[model samples]
Target chain A: MNDTTPNSYRTGPDERGRFGIFGGRFVSETLMPLILDLEAEYEKAKTDPGFWAEMDDLWTHYVGRPSPLYYAERLTEELGGAKIYMKRDELNHTGAHKINNVLGQILLARRMGKTRIIAETGAGQHGVATATVCARFGLECIVFMGATDVERQKPNVFRMKLLGAKVVPVTSGRATLKDAMNEALRDWVTNVENTFYCIGTVAGPHPYPAMVRDFQSIIGKETRAQMMEREGRLPDTLVACIGGGSNAMGLFHPFLDDPEVRIIGVEAGGHGVDDRMEHAASLTGGRPGVLHGNRTYLLQDADGQILEGHSISAGLDYPGIGPEHSWLHDMGRVEYVSVTDDEALAAFQLSCRTEGIIPALEPSHALAHVAKLAPTLPRENLLVMNMCGRGDKDIFTVAEALGSKI
Target chain B: MSRIDAKFAALKAEGKAAFVSFVMAGDPDYETSLAIVKGLPAAGVDVIELGMPFTDPMADGPAIQLAGQRALAGGMTLGRVLEMVRSFRVDDQTTPIILMGYYNPIYSMGVERFVAAAKDAGVDGLIVVDLPPEEDDELCLPANAAGLNFIRLATPTTDDTRLPAVARNTSGFVYYVSITGITGAASASAARVAPEVDRVRKATGLPVCVGFGVKTPEASAEIAGVADGVVVGSAIIERIAAGEDTASVLAFVKSLTEAAHGA
Candidate 1:
C-alpha cells in the first residue's frame, strides 16, 4: 500500500478485483450471493499468506512459474530489428500458459465447495488444461465443444478423454465455439446448484473476467523479473493474441504500471475484413452488447443478434470477446490490431523453419505482428512476446500446408 | 385495460384464456416489427410477448433463434427495441406487452434503469431466461414495484417443492415451459402438460399460460383443455423470418383463436 512500492507489483487482487475497466462481479441474483461469498473467501485467502505461499509452491514446483525469458538470438539476428526475447510459457506444464489459470480456478472452485466442473472449448487447449486439473483434483468434469472443433482437433479431444473429461458435442447453429459457450451457459443455468463453469477465456460476466486475469498475471510477473535481470529494463513492446483474451491479459497485467512498455493485441482477421469469413476480429469489428451475463463488445448483425465468427485458426474463431477487452480497447491504453490467417500461418512456418520452434496459431498471429514490427525498431530497443503455446496439436494444419498426405 | 389486474378482472367476467403470442420485436426490420405489434390486438393476440435478442439465446431453438438473428441482422438495437415497444403504445393502449430474453442484457443495462424504461415504454411483464424462483428478488421485486409482472417459467425441472415457490414469486401469468428444452424444440403433447397444469393449479391460483412447443392450432386447442392461456412463438416467428407479410400472418393467427376457445 506504500507509495514507493509500485501499485502493479503489490501481489494481491484489487479490493473489488478490477484491472482498469475490465473486471467486476456482474452476475444473476442467484449467483450474486455466491460471487459475494467468493469475493470474501478470496479476500480472506489472500490475507492467509499460506494460500499465497501454496500458489507460489504450485507455480514453482508443479505448475512451473518464473518460466525462462530466453533471448531468441538466432531469430533476432535474422530479423535484424530490435533484440527479441521470448517468455517461454510454451515450456510450462500442459504445453501452454493455460494450465496456470485453470489450476488457480480449480483450486478456487474446490474452496467454494463446488464438486463438478464444466467448460467450453474451441481449439481444445483450455479443455486439455481443464481436464488435467480435474484429474489432478479428482473432480468430475464435463466439456462442451462445437461438433466442428471436435472433428478438427481430434488429438485434443482424445487428450481430454484420456484425462477423464466427458466432451459433449454441441449441435447448436453453426456448431462452433460460440455454440459451445451457449451450451455451457445453459448447463450452468440448469445446474447452478452443484456445477461450476470453468470458462476458457477472460470473458463472461463480472468476477470471471477479473478472476481469470488475476490468475494469468503470473505470466506478466515472471516476464518482468526475467527482463530486468537480462536487459536491466523493460521491453519496448509487449504483444499477445486475443481469443477471449486470457493469454493476452495474462501477459499484460503485471506490466500495466510500466508506462514505457507498449502493449499490442492481435485479433484474427479470418479471410479479410470485408468478408465474414475474413474477420473474427471483435476488437476491429464489434459493438458493445450483453452476452453470457456481462456487457461486452460482440460481432452482431444490424438487428442486434449475435453473429457467428469465422477464422482459419479454430482457436481464435469467436463472435464476441471478453467484457474487459471491450473496456481495454475503449480506454486506448493498449493498441489492438488484426492479422490474417495467411500471415499467421506464414509466421508459424518461418519461426519453425528458421528457429526450430513451432507456435500455436493463436500466438502466431502475435508473432506475425512481431515479424512485421520488430525489424523496423532501433536495434537497441527490446521486444517481449508471450510465446503462449506450442503447435504440437497443429500437425494436421502443418501437414496440409506442406501438401503432404495425412 | 390499464394493468394485469384490470385485464384479468375483465377476463374473469368473460371466462376466457389470454391468447399470448411471442414475437421478437424488430425481426427482419423495425418497420415490419412495429406493424406486427400494431396488428396483434386486431388479430386476437391478447398479450404480446416481445423477445429481446441476445447473442447466446440458450432458451431458443433454431427457428426462433433465426428470427432473432434476422432482427439483429436488420440492425435492431436496444435503443430501437425500446422505441419499438413505445411505438406499440402509439396504436394500442389496452393490450399488455411483455419483454422477454435471457437476463444478460437487462443486467448489463442496469436493472432499475431497464425496468423503468420498460415501464415507461408501456411494457407490462418480463420473462428473463436464467432467472429462477430463488433469484426473484432482483428483477421480480423491482419489476413488481414498477407494476410489471416478473413472470417465472416452470419447466420439467420444477418438482412439487419448487413449483409452489415459482408460482408464489410470479405474476401476470405463470409461464409453463412445456418441455425441458428451449423454445421451438418439438411438437407439444397434451399428455405432457395436463399433469403439469394440474400440479401448478394446486400450487397456486394464479393464471397459468402454457408456452414452448405450442406450434399449431391443434396444439393450442390441446393445451386449452387444461391451462388458462396458450402461448405460441416459433410458428409465428417462422412466418416473419420467411418474409411473410403481417396481414397474412395475422390472418393465420386469427385461425388459432378457435384453438384457445376450443370452438
Candidate 2:
C-alpha cells in the first residue's frame, strides 16, 4: 500500500466508485441496475442548483442546520489545555447527524420516483431520522434494525414507530448493525421496483460512501466557516466518532487538504483492541475484506467469516469502517484510534457534568479521546470535536451501565 | 473444455437439463456433509454447487442461512471447504463442482491463492453472489485465467442494457434467479422463468441454469424444461436442517434430479 499523499484526497472513488482499492459496487446482479441508476441520478443532482436549493431550505428550516459550534468553556477549563469547541450537530432534527444524509437520499429517491424508503439502523438514530423524513414526505418507510439493537434502543424504536415507520428486527448473524444491513439489502433486491435504500452510514457500495459523505460534508463545510468566524482561522484539530465513519468523514473531508489541521477518528473499543476480537475498531484491528457491497476494513476470521463486533454504543457496533476511511488510513492522512467502553462511559458522564451536554454514546467515544488528548496539548491548540448525536435515547443504557435507576 | 462446459455439452447431447444441487460444505458435521456430497452423484446429480459457508449471507433465506450457521458451527473454513472438494474429487471428476458463496472468504484467502487452491482442489466453477460484472477484475478474470469457469447471475432486474455487461466475462452457465427475493422466500413458476431464461441464454450464448426458488421435484422439472439446468439449494438445505440422515437426504436429492432429467 502506497503511503504517498495525493495532491487532493477529495477526488476519490473514481468512475468505478473505488477509493484506492477499498470502495466499489460489490452487489448482486439484482441490485446493479438500481445502483447504477441511483449513481447517475446523484451525479445529476450534484450539478443541479435546484437540488441544493431545496436541501439548503430544508436544512435551515426543518433540520435547523448551520448547527451551532459552541465553545466548551467548562470542559476546556476542566481539561486545562486546548480550547474545545463542539459542532452541535446533536441539536439537529431527530437529534443526530444522520438526518443530513437521510434528507439528501430521500430527495434523490423522490427525483427517481421511489416512494418506499428502506434503511438499516444500529442505534436507531438513523432510523428515527429516516422515519422523520418519510413522514414529512408521506413516503412508506421500513427500518431494519438488529433485534438486539431494537431492545437496547427502545425509545428510538418507538420514535420511528410514532413516525409511522415499520421497524423490522433482524435476527441474523450476531443480530446487530451488520445483520440489519444484510436484511435491508435483501429487501432492496426483493423490492427493486419502488424501494429506495437510505443507508445510515458511509459504508455500502460505491455511490453510497461517496454520496453520504457529500451530504454529511455539510457538517464540515459549516464547521469550516464557523471556526473561521470564531477563531479567526481553521481549528488546529478535529475529532469525531466512527461507526461507519459518516460523521467523521463529514467533519474531516473539507480539512483533508488543509494539511495543517490534524484529524482523528475514534472507533468503539468494546473491551480493548487486543486479540480478543471484542471491539468495533475495524481499521485498528481488522483487515480488508468485502461486505455489504464494498471492500473495506472488516473484522473477519482467518477464513473470512465476519466476526461480530462488540460495543457499548449500538451505533458504533458495526464491524467495518467506511471504505474512504480505509483509504485515508492507508494514506496516513487521518489518525484512527479506539477507546474502550469503560472509558467511553466515563467520558459520557464527564460531558454531561462538565459541558452540560449529554452526548450520545457514539460521540462519547470521541469525547473520551478528546479528554485524553486535550489534557496533554497546549491551551492554544483549538480542538473541535463533533457532538454528532444527543443522549436522550441513551439515558436508559447509560443508567444501566452506571448501575443506577433511570 | 472445463468440467462445467463438458457437463453442459454432455447434457445437451443427452437432450436433458442438468440437475444442480447446492449444499453447504460441513453442514451438520463434516463427516455427514461429506457423506451426503459423495452420495449426490449416484443419486443423479449432474453438477454440484458446494456452498462455502459465510457468516453474512445477505442473498440467502432462512433455510440456507441456517445451513451455513450449522456449517460454521461445525468449524467450516475456506481451507476445510477446499479439502472437502479435494475429497469429493477423489471419486468424482466428471461432475462440475462450483464453490458458491460471497467474495470475502476467497478475498480473505487472497484472490490469486484462492483461485489456485480452488483450481487445485478440483473446483470447476464459481458463483460468488456479491461479485457482479462491475467488479469482475477482483476474482472473475483471475479465476477464469486459471482455467476455472467464473459463472454470473442474470436476474429479472438485468435488463437489455445490462445483460451484455452481466454476460461479458461470464463462463459456465448463467444462473437465472427465478425470483427477486432471497433464497427460499418464494416458489418459482416455470411460466414466469421461461421467458427470462430465454433472454439470458440469448444474451450470453451460454447455458442458463434457473435457481433461487426451485423447491419441489415438480418445480425442478418445470424449470428444467425451460432452462439448461435447475439448481435446488434451500430445498436440499431444508432437508439437511431437518436432521435427515445422509441416505434420506440423498434419496430426496435423487427424486429432484430424476424429475429434472426426465423433463
Candidate 3:
C-alpha cells in the first residue's frame, strides 16, 4: 500500500528493493520474505570487494569471461552480407550464452552464502550451464527440466548429470520449458534459505530479468567494441533468436541507443504461424499479459489462460519473451518476426553446409532470416545476429528433421 | 454499471474483496461440478470461475490441467460450461461468475460466437490465461464491449515498464500470481505475496486477488488480511483430486473465508 511505484526496485536492490521496472521481489509469499532477506544480504555481498574479487577471479579462471569475438571470414564471404561477424559467445566455456547469466547468478548465490543451486532448463542448455558452474564453484546444483525436453535433449541432460547436478524432470503440463520453470520456482519457494533459482533466460520475475540481462550484456559490450574495431562504426542491422530473449536483449541492448542499428528478433514459427503447432510468437501474434514476473507479451487465450505453444526447436518452445523485448517491440525500436520449422531446418543445414558452422535451432531461426535478408542487402550494409549457442546438442533433432537414413 | 464492475464496486464500497474459485465445468462429472457451483455462494464464496475444458492448458498446473482433463473425460465442452453457468445463474443472481480457461476452444468456437455464448451464459467476467494482452486487439476489446470483464494475471515479472499496459486492459479484479511459477504449486507464501500485492496495487486501481500457492485455511486467512481478496485453487483441486467430498470442501472454504476476513 505504500507508494512502491518509484522505489519498488532500486537500481541496487533499492530502498524497498526493485530495479527499474524489471527487478522486484515478485516471488511467492514464502519466498518474498526470504527474497527481502536475500536482497539485504546480496546488497551487503555486492558492496564487499571480496565478492567482486571472487567473481573476477572466477571470471578469469572458471567460466572464461571476455570470450573472444571471432570474425566469420568464411561465413561472410559465403553469405555475401556486410562483414557478418559473430560475437563468438558460442565458443564460451559452456558453448553458449546461457553461462554468462548463470555464472553471475551462481556467483551472486555463493555471495549470498547459499549452499544449494537450482535452475530450470528447456533444451538443457541452461541446466548444463548451471551445472557446469555449480561444479566449479562447489555449490550443490539441482536442475528442473521438462520430462519431454529431457528425452529429446538427451546429450545436454546427460551432460548435466555428468557435471554432478541432479536433474529433476518436471512432468507437469506439456512438460516443457514453462513446466520446468514452474518446478524451479516451486523449489526456490520451498528452499529459499539454502537454494538459489538460476533463471535460464532474461524472463523471470524482477531482479532476475535485469540481473540476467546485465550478466549477458557482456555479449553486447563485446559486439559493440569488436564491431567498432573492425567496421569503424556500428552495424546497420542486428538479429537474434528469442525464446526467453536473453541472448537477443543482451546483443541488442547496448546497441539500443545506436540509431543506425536496426534491431530484429526471430521467433520460432514451429510448423508455421498459421499452423496450430507454432512457437509462441508473442509480438506478431500474441498479446500483452503478465507471466513469470513483469507484464509483457504472453501466449494466452480469451480468459487470460496461458496456452502451451509448439515449436520444432525445444529451445524456442516457450510462451513468453523477455520483458525488455516486450518494451522494444511496443516502442517499435525492434522489428520482431518469426521463421518456420522447415525454413529454420533448411537454414540450420545451410549454415553447416555453407559456413561449416552448425548453429543451434534457436539461432537457426535467426539464420533463416539472415539467409533471406543478407543477400538482399547491399554489400555495404551489415547484418549481425547473436549465435546464442552452438549446435552440439541439436544433432539428434537436426538429424531426425533431415530424415536420417538408418 | 457492467455486471462485474457493479458487483465489485458494491464489494469495494463495502471494503471487501471477492473470493473467486475455479473448477472445470464437468470436472469428474457434469452434475458434480454443477452441484459445487450452486453450492459455492452459500459456502461464502463471492465469485465462481468456470474453466472450459480443453485438450491443452499450458499455463495450468498439474491440478487444474488434470481437472480440465477429467472434465473433458466426462464429456465436458464449452457448451457444457455455458449450460452450467446458465443453470447456476438461475438462483445465484447476486454472485458474479467468470469463465477462466484457454483460448483454443473459444477460438475454435469463433470469438464472436463465444462472446455471445458467454453473454447468454450470464457470465460476468473472463480470465483467459493463454490469451496474450497484445492479441486483445482482437479478443478483449470485443469481450469488454460485450459487457464482460476480461481479467488478466499480472505477475511479479510484469514490472512498471509493462504494468501500465497490462493494467490498462484489465476490467475485473487483477489475478496476481503469488509465485514466479505456475498455478497449483505448493510454493507460494504470504511473505512472497504481500510485496506483489503491494506492487500490483501500485500498478492499477483494480482490486488485487492473489493466487497460486494458497492451499490452507491459515494461508488464505493470512493473505486475505493483507490482499483485497484471496484466490485458493490447487488446494481445492487437490482435495477433489484426493477424493475429498465437495460438501466438506465447501465447509472448509467457508470457514477459511471467515478466517481470511479476520473473523
Candidate 4:
C-alpha cells in the first residue's frame, strides 16, 4: 500500500474500483453486467444536477439531513478531559445514520428504473431504513435477515413488516450478517432485471463500496460545516464504529485531507480480539482476503472458509470490513481499534446515565474507544464520535445483557 | 490441444451439441462422486463440470448449496477434489473436466500452485464464479498459463461495452448463463436464450454453452437447438442428492444427452 497523502484519500477505487489491492468486483459472471450497469448509472448520477437535487430535497424533507453535532457536555464533564461532541445521526429519520445511504441509493435505483428493492440487514436498522424509502416510492421491497437475527432483532423485523416489506430469514452459513449478505447477493444475481440491491454499508462489489461511501459522506460533510460554524475548525479527532465501515467512511472521508485531524475506526471486539471466532474486529484480528465481493480484511479459517463473527451488536457482526477501510488501515491513515462487548455495554449505560441519550450497541463500541481516548488528550482538544444509531431497537438486548428481564 | 477444444471439434464433426454434466465433488462421499463422474462420458455426457465445493457459494441455489454442504461434510477439500479428478482420469482421458467453484479455495491453495496441481490432475478447464475478467491476473491468467482453460460466463446483461472485456481472457468456451439469476433459481426460456447465444457467438468464436435453470431433457433439447452445448448442473446434482445410484443417475444423464443430441 502506498502512503496516503493528504489529497489521496478523497479519490478511491480507481476506474476498476480498486483501493490499493482491495475493492474490486469479485463476483460471478451473472452479477458482473449488473454491477457494471450500476457503475455507469452511478457515474452519471453523481454528475447529474437533478439527481443531487432530488437527493438533497429528500435529505432535507424526507430523510432529515444535517443531523445535529451535539456537544456531549455532561459526558465530557464526567470524562473530565477533551471536550467531546457527538455527530447525532441517530436523530435522522428511521432513527439511524443508515437512512442517509438508503435514501441516496433508492433514488439511484429509481433513476435506473428498477422497480424492486432488496437489501441485507443484521441489526435491522438498514432494513427499516430501506423499507421506509420503498414505502415512500411504492417499490416492492424485500429485506434478507439472518434467521438468528430475525429472532434476536424482532422489533426491527416488526418495523420492516409494518412498513410493508417482506423480511426473508436466511438460514445458510452461520445465519448472521455475513450469511444475510450472501443471501442478498444470491437474490441480486437471480433477480437482476428489476431488483436493485440496497447494500447497507460501504462493502460489496464495486460502485457499491465507493457509491455508498459517497452517499454516507453527508455525515462528514455536515460535521465539517457544523463544526466550523460552532468551533471554527475541524475536530481534533473523528471516531465512528466500523461494521462494513460506512459510518466511519462517512465521518472520515472529508477529514482525510485535514492533516491535523486524526481518524479512528472502532470495530466490534465481541468478547475480545483474541477470541478468534468471537470478534468482528477484522482490521484488528483478521488478515486481508476476499468475501462479499471486495478483497478486504476478513475473519476466515486457514482454509479460507469464512468464520462467523460474534458481536453483541448485530450491526457489527460481519466477518469483513469495507475494502476502503482495509486500504486506510494499511496506509496508516486511520487508526483501527477494537472494543469488547463488555466495554461497549459499559459505554452504552454510561451514555444513557450521563448524557441522557441511549446509544445503539454498535456506536457504543465507538463510545467505548472515545472514553479511553478523550481522557488522555488535553482538555482543549476536540473529539467527535459518530452516534450513528439510536438504542430503541436494542432495548431488549441491552436488558438481557444487563441481566434484567425486559 | 486441450481436451475441451478437441471435444468441441469432435462434437462439431458429429453434428451434435455437447452435453455437459455438473456434480459437486465428494457429494455423498468421494467414491460415489467419482463413480458418477467416471460414468458420465459413457452416459453421453460430452464434458464434465466438477464442482469444487467451498464454504460460501453465493451464485448457487438451494440444491447446489446443499450439495456443496454434503461435499464439505464428506471432507471434500481442494486436495480431495483434485484426487477425484485424478481418479476419474485413471480410467478415461477423452472427456474434458472443468473445476467449477468460487476462488477462495484455489487462492488459499496459491494460484500458480493450484493451477499446476489442477493440470497434473488432468483438469482441462476452470469456471471460477467469483473471479471475473477484471481479476484475470488473480487466477485466470495463471490457470491459462498452466494449460488449463479458463472458461468465462457471459450473461444477458453483458452489453456490447462489457462483452469485449468478458470475452478478452476467456478460453475453452463461453458459459452463457441462460437466466439472469443464480443456478436453478428459475426455468430458462429458449426464446430468451437464443438471441443471447447469437449475440455472444458473434463476439467470440468459442462455442457458447448455456447453463442455469436448465433441468428437463426438453429444456436441454430446446437450449441445444440454439447453443453449441447445453450444460445441466443442479438437475444432475439433485438426483445424486436424492441418493440415486450411479447407474440411475447416469441413465437420467443419458436421457438428457440423447435429447440434446437428438436436437
Candidate 5:
C-alpha cells in the first residue's frame, strides 16, 4: 500500500493514472503506446489556453452552456421538506449530459489528427451525442451497441445513422453496455493508426475516467455558481444517478473538497441489490475487480466472470462503476445508494406529473432516492439533483412498462 | 531455471523453434480438455498456453471468445483451471504450462494466493493479455517473486521508445504480437514480424515468441523461422469448436508443431 493519503480529494489519479489503486492503465500491450500518446496530448492540452478557448467556444455556441439550474417547486412541495433543484443538462444539444464530454474528447481527437472515431453506448444517448459531434467535424464515426440495446433503442440508432455513423450491434456477453465496450476496445486496438475511441462514461482506462470527469465537471461548476446566485449558499446535498457514474462524477467532483456538502450517488437496482445479481449497483452489490481496462467495483461471479446486470433503464444496465466512484466509496467521501426499478418507475411518473418534466429512467433512480431522502431532512436543507437526460428516447419503453402501448 | 527456460534452451540446442499451443481449460468439459492437454507433448508441442476463460475477452476474436464461453458454460473457474494444471502435472513435468487470460479471476482469487496456487499447480509462467508493464506491480512482480515467469507482450504498437519498459522485469521469453489487431483477426506476415521479433529479442535479451493470427502450419513455419517460438491459439480452439475429437485436435496440432520444428 502507498500509505500516503492526499488531504484533498480533487487532486487524485496521481501521475500513474491511479486513483488510489483503483484506476490504472490495464490495457493490452497493443494499445499501451496509444494510451500514452493520448495521455501526453491531454497533458499538453490541459495547459494550452488555445485548447480551452476552443472548448469554451463550442460549449457556449454549439452545446448551449450554462444549462439552467431550476428550482423544482412542485417536487419540493410534494416531498414536503428540503427545497429541490434540477440541473437542466438534458437541454443540451444532444438532449443529455453525454455531449459535454463528447465535445472535449472530439476536440482532443482532432488535435491529435485522428480522423476516425469509435464509441460504445448502452441506451444510445452517448452514441447520438458522439455521432452528432462526428457529423459536425465531418469525421468518420462508428458506435458499438449491444444487439439488445439496438433493438430497444431503435430511435437513437436511426438518429446515429442519420448523423452518418455506422452502428455495430454486439451480441457477446449479456449483449449490453459491457459487451459494447469490449467491441469498441477491439475496434480501437485494430484501428489504432487513425482511430480515436471516445468512451461515453467515466470508466475504461485511467485518463478516460479523469478526462471524462474533467469535461463533465462543467455540470457541477455550473451548479455551484447557479446555487450561489439563486440560494445565496452552496446546496446542502448533491445527488445523481450512476451507470458508469459519469454524471455523478461530474456533479460531485467539483464539490468533493466541500466538506459541508453531502454527496450521494444512486445506482440502478434492477430487481434489487440481492443475491440474485439482478442490479447494476456495482458499489452497493459488487466487489473490486478489473474490467474494461481499469480496476473498479464490478458484478462478477466467484470465478471473476462478469455477470450481466439488469435494469429497466438500458443506460443503467452496466455491471461496473467508474474507478473514481469506487475510490470515493472506499474513502467515505460520498454516499452510494440503490433504488429498485419499481421505485425509479414511480419517480419517473412523478417527475412527469408533478414537475411537467419527463426524466430518463437513469436519473429517475436518483429522483427516487431524492424523494425518499428529502422528506427526512429539515425544511431549510437545500438539495440539487442532476436531470442528466431527457425521456424523449425512452417513451416507448416507458409506455410498455406502464402497461400502455405506444 | 524454470521449465519454460529449460524447454526454450532445449529447443535451441536441438536447432528448432518451440511450438506453443493454447487451449481453454474445461472447454467443452474438464475431462476432454485434460485429454487434449495431455496429448499436446506427444503431439510435439514444446510449451502449453492454458487459457483461463473469462467472460469478456476484449483482445480475442470470435474463435477464442467462443472457446472461453464454452469453457465458462462448462463451469470452468480459476480453481478448476488450477486443478487442471495440477492434474496435468501428475503426468508431465518437463513441458512448461503457462496460464493465459485476463486479470480479474486471479485478482478475485487474491493475487498473492493465486500466484502461490498457480506455482503449486505447476504453472511455470503467465501471459495476462490486459496487464501491460504499467501494471507489473499488480501480478507480475508477485508472480515473479513466487518463482513464476511473468511474460510480457511486445506488440506492433510497442515502439522502440517503449520497448525498455516492456522488457524490464520480464522474466520469461517475450511474446511478440504479430499484428496490431485481436487474436485470429488477420494473418501475420513473416516479413512484417521478423524485424519486430529481432527488436524485442534485442531489447529484452529473451527469446521472442510470435503469436496472434498464426493459424496454419505454413504460417507457423513462417513465423518460427523468424522467432524462437510460435504460438497458435485460435486455430487449435477452432478445431475444438468444430467438435473434432481429441485425436483429431492432437493430429492438427502435430502438423503445426512438425512444421514449426522443421523450420
Candidate 6:
C-alpha cells in the first residue's frame, strides 16, 4: 500500500496471487469461485479496523500473544559459538504456533458466517489448534488426518476429539499428509456453501499461503521488537524447520527486508537425501510443480506423480513446501538445508537436557541445523530459531527411534 | 475436421445428445482396461474419455480414486496411457477420445512433447482438471496450438461473472460439472442443471456437456434432454472397480448410451 515497502523482501505475489511465479490459484473450476470470494473477503478484512480489533483481542486474551524469546544460555554456553535464542511459540495455548493462524482464520470464518470448519493435519498439532478454536467459537469442526498419522499422533487425535472435533482418518495413497490434504480439498469443494477450510499451513491456493503467513507473522513481528528492545540489534541468523513452511514463513517474513539478517530453513532428510532413502526435503530434492493448490517445489517423480516423502517426524513429511519459500529459495534470499532423522532426534534430546524444553520433532530439525550452524559462526552472532511446537506428542516416536519401550 | 468437432456436429445434425463414457486407461490391469476401452465405441458410446491415472487425484471421489490407485499399482504410467490410445486408434478412427486427468504428469512429460504425442496418438482432446483458464498459457494454449481440443469445465459455482473467463479459449466442448463437488460425490438433477447448461451455452458457442454426477441411464437421459452431451465417469468406473467383465461393462455403457440417444 505504500511506496516505502522494501524492494527486496516484502513485495511479492502481485495481483494474481503469484509469489514471483511460485504461488497461484491452481484449483479446479468447482473451487475457483470460492477461492475468489475468499480472496475478496480477506482483502476487505485486511483493511477493516473492526477485524483487526477482534483479532487482537483474541490474540491477547484467548490465544496468548507475545510468546517469549527465551535465551537458551545453557545450550549457548555448551555450543560455544553463536548466542542461541528460542522464540518459545510452544507455550501458545494449543501447545504450538499453529494456534496463531488458527485463531485468526476461525475469527475470519466467524466474520464470514461460515458454520462448519474443516482442516487437514499431519502431526495433529494444527488439528488440535483448529478444534480448540472451533469449540471456542461454537462452530462445527472436522479434521482429516492420514491413517498413519492418526496411529502415531494418538494424543493429538484424542485432544481434537476432546475439543469436540471429528478426526476423520484418511486411508488413501500412502495414508499421509498429502492424501489428507486431498480429502480436505474434496470436503471444501463439496461443502463450499457453508464450510470454511482452515488450512493448517501456508501451502494452499492463493489467499491461503498469503493469509496464513500474515496471521503467523506475529512470530517475526514480536521477535523483531523483542530483539531490538533486549539486544539493541537484530539477530544475525534466523532458523526454522519447514513442512508446508508456516512456522518458517512466520519467522522469516518480517526479517525479509533486513538485508543484514540471514534466514535458514531446515527440511527433514528422512534417512538421507539419497536415492535409496526417502526424505521430505522439497527444495533440495524436488522441482517446481503444482499440487494441492499452489505451484511450488514438489517431491514428484519423472512422470510428475507425487512421491510420498518419508520423515521421522510426521509434521515434516509433506512432499511440498509453501510457495513463498519456493520464491525465496529462487530469489536466494533464504538458505534452505536438510537434517537427517538421527540428527533431529539428537537435537530433541539435547534441548530437553540442556534447556529443559522439549521441542516438537519438526522444530528439532531446525535445532539440529542450529547445532551445526551455531558452532560455525562467531560467538557474538545472534542466532534465533522458532521453537514452534512442544514435544509431548512425539514421546512415543522418540522412544521407538531410541529402541526403548515407552 | 477434428474427430471431436465432427462428432459434435454429427450429434447436432441427428438431433441427439452424445453419450461420453470415462474409464481409467489401465484399471485392474492394462490388458483388461484396453479390452474395455476398445469395446466402448461398439457399446453405443458416442465419445470415449480415458483417464490418465495420477498418484494424487484430488478432485475424484472414492470410485474414481480407487480406480486410479489400481491403475497406478498395475504400473499404468503416462507412456502406457498413450500406448493404449495409439493401439485404440489403429482400430477405431471415428470416435473422439479425450485424455482427462490432472496436469502434473503432462507437465513432467514436457507440454510440447505431450501435446505432439497426444495428437500423433489419435487423441482428440484434453480435460486437465486442475488447470484453469488462468493457467491456459501453461498447457491449454499449447495443446490448442498443437491442434488438440483443450476442453474446460464449468461448474455450479461458475457464476455469470466468472463464466466468460472459464469459457475463453475453450474448445471441443464445455464440461458442465452439475454439482459443486468432486466427481461421483452427488447425484445430478436435471431441474438444477438445465438452466446452468443454458447459461453456459450462452457464454460459449461450443456444445456444453454435463458431467460429475450423472450416474445412471435415467439420469443420463434427463441430462441429455437439457444439454448437448452427457459425460458419465464414476458410474462406469464403479463397474470396472467391482470386477465386472468387459462384456458386462459394455452392456451397462450401451444402456446409458441408448438412454441418451433416445432422449
Candidates arranged by lDDT, highest first = 5, 2, 6, 4, 1, 3
In order of DockQ, best first, we have: 2, 5, 6, 4, 1, 3
Candidate 4 error regions (>4 Å): A3-7
List interface RMSDs for the candidates, in order: 5.5, 0.6, 8.7, 1.2, 0.7, 0.9
Model 6's DockQ score: 0.83
- Cα shift from native, residue B234, model 1 (Å): 7.5
Against the native chain B, what TM-score does each candidate's chain B reach? 0.94, 0.99, 0.95, 0.98, 0.99, 0.98
Count of steric clashes across candidates, in order: 13, 0, 44, 1, 0, 1
The runs of at least 3 residues in candidate 2 whose Cα sits more than 4 Å from the true structure, single-residue gaps closed, are none
User: What fraction of the true Cα-Cα contacts (under 8 Å, chains A to B) does candidate 5 also have?
Assistant: 0.85
Candidate 6 backbone clash number: 1
Q: Between prediction 5 and prediction 6, which has the larger lDDT?
A: 5
**Docking level for model 2:** high
lDDT (Cα, 0-100) at B36 in candidate 6 = 94
lDDT of every model, 2 decimals: 0.78, 0.93, 0.76, 0.91, 0.94, 0.92
Worst 10-residue lDDT window, candidate 2 chain A: A1-10
Tens-digit per-residue lDDT, B110-227, candidate 5? 9989999999999999999999998989999999999999999889899899999998889769988888899888977999889888889899999999999999999999999999
Candidate 4 residue pairs in backbone clash: A190-B181
All candidates' TM-scores?
0.76, 0.99, 0.71, 0.96, 0.99, 0.98
Which candidate model has the greater TM-score, 5 or 6?
Answer: 5
Model 1, range B1-263, lDDT digits (tens) per residue? Answer: 34765666676678777778888977878898888888988888888899887767876777777777687768766667788989889877888888888765676666898889988998888888766554565578898888888887776656675666777767777788777556786656888788888787678777778888888888887887778789999988888877889898888787776677652
**Could you tell me how far off, in angstroms, the CA of residue B88 lies in candidate 1 after the best superposition?**
8.2
Task: Write down the DockQ of candidate 5.
Answer: 0.88
lDDT of 3 by residue, A1-406 (tens): 1223332111333442232222233333344445545556655765778866876676667667666666666767777766676666777788888988887787778767789999888888888999999998788999999999988888898899999999998886678888788777666755555788788887766556666777778788888887788778888889899988999988987877777788899988887775363666877778765566445677876554567777878888888888767766665668999998899988888878866888888898998888888877888887788888889888878788888953
Candidate 2 collision pairs: none
- After best superposition, candidate 4 residue B135: deviation in angstroms? 2.4
lDDT (Cα, tens digit) per residue for candidate 1, span A124-164: 99999999989988999999999999999999999999999
What would the per-residue lDDT of candidate 5 be over residues A1-406, giving only the tens digit for each residue?
3445558999989888888879999999999999999999999999999999999999999999989999999999999999999999999999999999999999999999999999999999999999999999999999999999999999999999999999999998778889999999999999999999999999998799999999999999999999999989999999999999999999999999999999999999999999999889999999999999999999999879899899999999999999999999988889999999999999999999999999999999999999999999998999999999999998998899889976
* Listed models, DockQ each: 0.20, 0.90, 0.08, 0.72, 0.88, 0.83
